[model samples]
Target: MSIATPQNPALAAALILAATTFIAATTLMAKALGTDVLGTPLHPMQISHGRFLFAFMGISTGVLILRPQFIRPHWGYHIGRTSFGWAGVTLMFASVAYIPLADATAITFLNPVFGMLLAIPLLGERVGPWRWGAALIAMIGAMILLRPTPASFQPAALLALTAAAVMGMELIFIKKLAGREAPLQVLWFNNLLGLAIATCAVLPVWQMPTPAQWGALAALGLLMACAQACFINGMARADASFVAPFSYATLVFAALYDFLGFGAVPDAISVLGAVIILAGAAILAWREGRQRPHDRAPAPAAK
Candidate 1:
């Protein structure tokens, strides 16, 4: 049986909000696991490994319970999506380990900007002047956030930016696969393939987690699974453009988690830059949402 797609707009909005909160919680968990902020610090790869491993466990269990026939889809697209997604996740975890959560999250918003550029060649999508202008504004926002100078440059920010770029490519693959595959199929393939690939790195530097650390890792995986489910359900229920803008709430949740958990506040420049980037993204989403009926294609899947 297919998963139920929510039809109520209010419920869909609530689900999106919940999904963003869960995503923000994952950043906090990842930071705690990968940094000395909480339990024993795990290597970024180990953290990535645990992320996918536990996510696979949780999602697979759900599939068994709700949709046993969901397995064994087209493997080629699955591999492509998982490969890009794993690389993106690894870099993003590394970025969070070194940089403030808010900063890293803000940099990742460039996925949409990069997506527009990739769409031209990959999907034969047209780019109009308005989107080009939005991309320019977003680029300026990235610069303002990075503040790349001899005295103020941060290499770590580049990691997040690179992750965003990889995720943009991943979105293109998702677009290709979405039409032929169910959302749960894509979700299962991501975690399952991610776990298999991440294991290679984990075996070399694995440290047995303490009970608390194990709990954290498990929670991280569960949150990710839940978040993805909510995200897909919301998108299925509402217009993709309507759902897309709420994703910026991840940054808000990140900033809040940073302040309350780590006491690391984003400086003025970072805040302003985040606002600008969000504005550009909103413009892009709004324009895409307004596309004529005949011009509509699948909107990029949310992370």
Candidate 2:
């Protein structure tokens, strides 16, 4: 039992870190494919559309093989949940192109803070003192990261913040929907929604990608799917908080990829901000681990 705590948490965090790092690296590759190979011709929307198109097909194919009947879900929750995911995907992809990966990822750490705030009203989940303190510290760290001045800030940072906010909303809806459907069903709706929204946003301006660009898009889709799968499996095996902070490892991977692959390195200020982001995530993880003792399945009643 004791072994499960550290062992499972470490395994889950490692899996999540790998998944997120791959996804972050793929984003860097997408930028190269778009700019260098595609001559900066592929719009963000177009890339999103292509990526989601492949993802939807991939998920649909798997569903057909593994669970044929899932082709049609309960339309109401499916549509609702899909909408949240749609917005999250669109916003997140847009941010990826506009912001530095480290900054973008740091802003994303705000999601759980927002989630904690929303839970008080939406889910009736308590915010407790320790979690609230952690959230405050996280927000201060976010301000340092954002800088929020013309000389210091890029407008793209705001986009990443908005992406985080939207992600918070998506997560809330996901939590609500989880009890009603299998996780795979939720994942299917997410991809379908991503495709639908990306199509609606990008179709008017869509230009077909060249073979190389298409290959990059395919790679991007595969990495995105892999990240989602590993994240889900990891969380199922351990606590979300325990697994969440390592998601920040994507920042390290992103920075390294950008430097080696694109010659872009984050500044010292950005590095400090990244540290704060990791600190906040660590605080959240510790809080959850401590709470675990108080959480357990109810004992079976005597006959």
Candidate 3:
């Protein structure tokens, strides 16, 4: 039987909020896996592999139990989406190892802005002044996080920015898939393909995870799967714009997780940049909500 998901804006936002918690926790897990805190740092590719492999396993089990029916998929869209999603995830794992999780998470809020810009070429969508202005404001916010000055420049932060761009590209494919199939089916195909792609990419960097590392990887994968499921079901129930702002709660959870897990607090710049980015994103989401038809919404939250 398909899961019942009645449209409930309050429930959707709550689910997204739950997803943010899982997402933030996964980053903390990734940071542990990527650094010596858990053991010797794992390669980002290897870490990404763990995420896909274990997430696929968990989702495969669900497929067996739930037995959700699927439509004939758009193979090209799934491949494109999974490939870019895997790359973005790998880059995110790499960045968390080197910078504060709050900084990395804040920087990645650019994905939507990047998605808006990318739509011009990919979807033939026209950009109005509202979108352009929102994108500009968002870019300025990202620059603040980059702290391009010699004294504060952290090159590792660029990985987060690039991840945002790649995820934005993934968003284009996601838009193509939205409303085309059951959300569960889309998710299963995504992780299945993600596993295949990440497995190939990990060959050069693969290492046997330590016992504790293995556990962390397992936790990371499970958390991500849960996050994806909550996000998908949530989006299906509400306008994307209505719940999109709630997703920014990830930064707060990240900062709290980082501090509790590793005692790292968000410094001044992290808070300022994240706030500005939220402002820009809120503008874009508000505008998109007003202009787009009620049926059009983001497919799901891409972690």
lDDT of 3 by residue, 91-139 (tens): 9999999999999998888998888788887787877888789889888
By lDDT rank, best first, the candidates go 3, 1, 2
Clashes of each: 0, 0, 0
lDDT of 2: 0.67
TM-score of each: 0.93, 0.85, 0.96
lDDT values of the candidates?
0.81, 0.67, 0.88
Model 3 local distance difference test score: 0.88
Off by over 4 Å in 3: 1-5, 294-300
Candidate 2 wrongly placed segments (more than 4 Å): 1-11, 33-37, 68-76, 292-303
Task: Return the top candidate by TM-score.
Answer: 3
Clash pairs (backbone) in predicted model 2? none
Assess the local accuracy of residue 157 in candidate 1 as a C-alpha lDDT between 0 and 100.
88
lDDT by residue (1-303, candidate 1, tens digit) is: 234554677777888889989988888898888887666798878888888888889989988888745645778878888888888888888889888899888888888778778888877888888778877887788888787998988898899999989988887777666546567777888888899999986798899987888888898888988998888777768876788888889999999998898898899988998998888888877887887632333354445
- Write down the worst ten-residue block by lDDT for model 3: 293-302
Clashes of 2: 0
